[model samples]
Target: MNDHDGPTPGNLVATVRAVLPSLTPAAQAIARLILEDPAMVARSTITEFSAVSGTSEATIVRTARALGFAGYSQLRFALAAAVAREEPERLVPGDLGPDDPLTDVIAKVTRAESEALADTAAQLNPDRLGTVVEAMVAARRVDVYGVGASGVVAVDMAQKLMRIGRPGHAFADAHLALTSAALMGQGDVAVGVSCTGETPDVIAPMQLAHKGGATTVAITNNPRSSLAELADHVLVSAGRETAFRPGALASRISQLLIVDCIFVGIAQRTFETSQAAVRATRSALDEYMADTRRRNK
Candidate 1:
């Protein structure tokens, strides 16, 4: 139900990263191989992969299953599919290099962002999305919390909800966010957005909301982080950081894609009200534009 209309082989590296912490050391090595060069791993047989990882075939099978694949063969199939699905030009490593031409920089950035969007779409679970949308629609009010780059996305999410006649607020300040969570209760819902999943500003408010009996949701890149553990529903975005912009998420296209899905789902669930709200909002904007034009004339 995502951009692909359903699940396709997303980034095999992302799938592996989601479960990386739980893997055994030997299995972890093989997992790293999959992450590092999935194309090579895909072409490698069990015996060959075993030799590459310095692990036995038995360990390979266990690693494959741990990664949610049926077996080693299935793992390789997914990796191959993911690699094959990429554009031929994108086959090269996406890392930005120093002293590279400006054109190459542009291409690398576009490639990274494109991969982040597609991989995020692939990893997004439709059932979880439905749950979040349902919670948003039924909530008395929704509070969104984020800081820095994620805060921008939080504002966009809240704006979309408000345009659809839903009571939504975005808080960038920790004090304001915590205050909002303080009043939340059973019928309310709170969402925290943090790329690294460890942002104290976001996590504190969401944890408080959870303790106050409100439904809490987390949208983060790291599924194994504290924010994910705290929220009632966790939405993961597969945005791998690139050397171009190490810490900042830039436009955070992957997270925005997740928000778009949530907003669309909620709008679909309450079509008539949302449609009317959108129309009304648009008319107000049009009127403002007309007034500005008349004044200019």
Candidate 2:
């Protein structure tokens, strides 16, 4: 069995980015060197990498482990594969420098978001997503659980599914979420949204839903997290967090992309009904818009 739980084998940079925050200081030093230039690292020997990263050989091995690699040699091979597939223009976001100007910050942030989305798309397992979508489309009802920023994403997903004539609800409150999850059965679907995949508020409800026999899905950045372990299907997202932005923007963007994918897949599966429902919802909104226009006039 494969011991690594990070990104898929060919996506070394993304795997590193996803686990970077959890690595120790000595390991991070080695990781930074690899991230800065994966191709260079791939070509370098372990001793060279240790010297360049200002870390010991043991630190290098530990860093490799933190990235879900069994050892330095495996990491090196994966890095080589990543280098072969890497695009010249693709940019991986590094730590935000204190003296970066406004323009540079904007560029860096946009690049980070782009990379996160790309990595997520690359790492997504289509069979897993398809299975979840099939379960959701055939479900009697769907319940989504999230807290804080993830709660907002859950609401967005629920709204999308509802607009497409699917019976879906989002719960952010812990008590309410648990209550709702407890009522789910085999024909129901439950989705949990958490970037870190360790949010207790989100994970508990998902666990309840699973125990209740609902098909459980987890959208998270960490595949090794408890949420993923509990889920029937796991959708992974990729984003690197900096000191200034902990689990902010990039994570949200990545999660939203996954939400949109699930929504679109379901909508496509029930095309005619979804189209009719969308039209009906739009007509209802149009009437409200007309009333507001008349009032303004």
The most accurate candidate by lDDT is: 2
> What is candidate 1's lDDT per residue for 1-297, written digit by digit as tens?
112122236555565655565567888788777767878888999999888889999999988776666788888787788778762233334577788899998877877777778678778888889989999999999999999889999999999999999999999999999999999999999999988788999999998999999999988886767888888888878666655685445337888999999999999999999999999999999999999999999
Clashing pairs in 2: none
Q: In candidate 2, which residue ranges exceed 4 Å CA deviation? A: 1-10, 21-33, 44-74, 84-92
Per-candidate TM-scores read 0.83, 0.85
Q: Please estimate how well model 2 matches the true structure, expressed as its whole-model Cα lDDT.
A: 0.83
Predicted candidate 2 versus true structure: per-residue lDDT over 1-297, tens digit per residue: 013345444466667766665668888777777777878888989899888888888888888887877888888888777777763235355557889898888988888888888888887777777888899999999999999888989999999999989999999999999999989989999999998888999999999999999999888887768887898888888875678778678888889999999998998999999999999999999999999999999
lDDT of 2 at 198: 89
